[model samples]
Target chain A: MQEVVNFIDLNLIMVGYLFIVGFTGGLVSGFIGSGGAFVLTPGMMSLGVPGTVAVASNMCHKFPKALVGAIKRYKYGQVDIKLGLVMAASASLGVQIGIKIQQIILEKWGQAGSNLYVSLSFVLILVTVGGYVFYDARKSARRTDTAGEMVSNLARRLQRIQLPPMIHFKTADVRISLWLTLPVGFATGMLAATIAVGGFIGVPGMIYVLGASSLIASATELVIAFVMGLGGSINWALHGMVDIRLTLIILAGSLLGVQLGAIGTTYVKEHMIKIVMGTIMLIVAFSRGFAIPQYLAQLKLIEVEENTIRILSAVSFGIMCLALAVGAVIILAAMWKGRFAAEEGAELPDKGSSLEVVSQES
Target chain B: MSGRSYARRKRPYGKVIGFGMLTAALYAAVYLNAPVVMTYFTKGGVYAVLPIATVFLFSYVHGTFAGSLWSLLGIDAKRTRLQERMEKRPAATRKISRPRPRLHA
Candidate 1:
C-alpha cells in the first residue's frame, strides 16, 4: 500500500501531461480505431508509475472511451456490431493464449528477454504491415475517382468459399465464412495481448481480408476494443492494480478528443484513415527500433555505456510521442479542410449545394 | 437529411449544460475525496466493482456531455453518401446470398 501510494505522486505537470497525451491518443484511436496505448503505457512509466499500474489504469480508461467512440461512430453508420462481437469473442480466447506465451518467455529469458521479444515483434510487424497499408493508401490517393474502398482480391476469394455458417455484416457489406473470421479475430486478440494494441491487426484484417471498407473496419474496431478492454480492466481491477485517479484524468481529455475524432471521420476522405494509420505505425516502429540496443545490452549481447542506453531510451519515448502528435495533426488538418470545403459548397447554387465535399482530397 | 440529424444540428445547450454540471460534480466528489476513494477502490476482491461501476457512470454522464458539447460547437458528423447508406441499411429481411454450388468437371 505504501509503495503504491509513493508511486502515484501526481502533480500539476504530470496531470497536464497525462491529459494531453490522453486527448491525442483518444483522437488517434477514434480516427484509426486503435492506438495510444503504445505510447501511453511507457509515458506513465516514465512518470514513475509502476508498469502494472499504468497498464491497468490505461485499460480501465480504454473501454469507456471505446464505448463512447463506438456509439458516436455507429450513429454515423460506420460500425458493424455483428462483426465486432464475433471478433471480440475470438479475441478473448486469443488473449489467454497470448498471455500464456508471455509467461513462458518471462520464465525462460526473464524481463530483458521478454522486452527484447516484444520490441522485435513491434518493429517487424509495424514495418511490414505499415509499409503495405501506406503503399495501398498512396495508390488509392493517385486515383481521384475511386468511389469507396475497393475489395481486395484475397477478400473476394475468401468470400467465394462456401464454408458453413456464412455471416453477412450489414454495414461492412461483406458476407464471409465464419471460419475465416476466427483466425483474424484470434490474431487480433493475440496481438492485443502481446503488444497492447490489437486494432493494429484487427482493423487491417477487417479491411484486407473481410473486405470491409477502411471506414467500417476502423469504426467496428472500437466495439472490439470496448469488449476486450472491459474484460481486461475487470481482471486488472480485481487484482487491485487500477489507479482510478489516473484513469479519470485520462478520460477527461479522451472523451472530448474521441468525439472530435469520430466527427472528423465523417468529414475526411476514406484513404486519409489509412494514411494516418500507416504513418503512425511506421514512426512507432522506428521508435521501438531505437530501444532495441538497450535491451540487447541488458542481455549482455552487446556492451554499451549507461549514458548511451539512457539516451536511446529517451529517444525512443520522444519518437513515440511524435507518432501520436503526427496522427493528431493530420486528423485536425483534414477536419479543417473538410469544414472549409463544406462552407464553400453551401454558398454555391442549389445544384451544387451538397452537404459533403466528397471529392475534396488533402 | 434525416430529421433526427437536422434536430441534432440545432444546438441543445440545455442538455449539454445539464450533463456538464453533473459530470463536473461527479469528478469533483471523486477528486476531493481522493484518499477515501483510493483506499476503497483498491481494496480488491468484490470491491473491484466500485471502480468498474464508477467508470461506467462517469462514461455515461461525461460521454453525453461531450457529445452535446461537440454538437453545440457544430462538429457533428456530416451527411455523407456512405453515411446515408449506413443510416438506411437494408432490414434483416433482405435476402442473404448463399454460395452457388459448383461442380468440377
Candidate 2:
C-alpha cells in the first residue's frame, strides 16, 4: 500500500496564522536559541497538518534559522565555535539514542504509550530545570553588586575538578574537563530528539552546570541546535516527511523575527534570557501536564469523559501558545525599554545596583 | 548616538532589493507549481534531497534579504562604549588546581 502524504491545504488565513506564529516563534528562538520549535510543531498540527509532517517541517525550518542566528551571534563575538562543535558531536550521538528509545516505545505500546512517555519526560524535566532557573534569576536580580556574571555553585565545583585535557572555551572564558562538557551536549541532543526543543536544556546546562554566561550559553546552543536540527531534518526528509511549502513560509517569517530577537539580546541584560527561558519552560510544562490526562485516558490508565478530555487537550494547546506569546512579549518589551534607555542617554543601573542607589538617594 | 546619526549609517538597500526580488520569484514558482514540486519532494527515496536542498536555498537567499531589511529599518544592535570595552578586554583565566599525588602511608 502506498503511503499518502498528509499535506494541509493552505488558505490565506492559514498562511497568515503560520506567518504570525513563525514570527513570534522566531523572535523567541533568536533571543533564547531553542524555543521556536516547541510552539511551531504544535501550531502546525493544530492547522490539520499531520504530527509527522509537522515535526519534519519544523525540523526543516530549524536548521536554517539556527544557522542564520549562529552567524549573527558569531559576528558579535558571543559564539564559541570550538565549544559548540565539540558539544554538537556528542549531542548527535545522544540524538541517535533518543530516537531509538522513542522507536522502541512506539513499537511496544503504540501511539498512546509513546505520547504518554513524551509528556511525562516533558513535565519532569521542565519543572525541575525551569524552577531552578527561575529561582537563580530572581536571586541574581536581588543582589546589590552585579559587577560580574554569577557563576552557579555546581559550575564552580565542576571547574575546580583537575581533570586532564581541559579544553579552554575562549569566548565563554571557561576551562573545564572535556568529559564534563559531553554530558551537557548529550542531554541537549537527547531532549532535542525527544521534545524538538533541546535549547531549553542546552542553554541552561551551559550556564548553570558548565559556568558559561547566559549570552554565550544561549548563542552556543544555536550551534548545537543547527547540527542536531540538520541531522533530524535529513532523517525526516529521507522518509519524505517534509512539506517544503510549510517550511519556506515559516522560514520567511522566522528569518525576520530571529534577527530581531538576536539583536534584542545585545540591548538587554544577561538575566533577561534566563527570565524568559524559565517563564516559557514552566508554562509549557504546565501545558504538557494538561495534555497528559487525555493520553492517560487513551491508554486506559484513567477514565475521563470525552468532552472533558477534549477540553483539556484544547487548554493544553492554548497554554502552549500563551507561553510563546508571553515570552515574545517579554523579549520585545525588554528590548524596547533597553533601546529607549540607550537612546535617551539614561544609563540603566547594573542588575543589583538599582535598589541600592534608590535607597541611598532616599 | 543620536537617532539621526544612527539613521545615517549606510543601509544595504541594493542587496535587500536584489535578494528580495529573487526570494519573491522563488516563492512564486514554488506556490504556482505546488503539485509537481509536492509530488517529487515526497517520493521518499533519493528524491528526499529536493526538500532539504530547497529549504537550504530559501534560507540563504531569504535570510540575507531579511537581515538587510532589518538594517535598513534601523533595527540594529546597540554598539555601546561599555560593550566595546568589554569586547576589547582580555579573556579571564580560571585557576586550575593540579592534583597532588599522596605518599603511601
What is the lDDT, from 0 to 100, of the residue A298 in candidate 2? 89
Clashes of each: 0, 0
Please write out the lDDT profile of model 1 over residues A1-362, one tens digit for every residue: 42344438679998999999999999999999999999889999999998999999999999999999999998887889999999999999999999999999899989998999899989999999888999998776664353445668999999999998999987677899999999999999999988899998999899899888788899999999999999999998887888999999999889988989998887777788889999999999999999999999989999999999999999999999999999999999987877666655543111111122222210
The reply for model 1, stretches above 4 Å from the true place, is: A1-7, A346-362, B1-8, B89-105
Candidate 2, superposed: residue stretches over 4 Å from native: A351-362, B1-4, B80-105
Q: Mark the 10 consecutive residues where model 2 chain A has the least summed lDDT.
A: A353-362
Which of the numbered candidates is closest to the native, going by highest lDDT?
Answer: 1
Give iRMSD, candidate 2: 4.4
Candidate 1 — which pairs collide? none
TM-score of each: 0.91, 0.91
Docking class of 1: acceptable
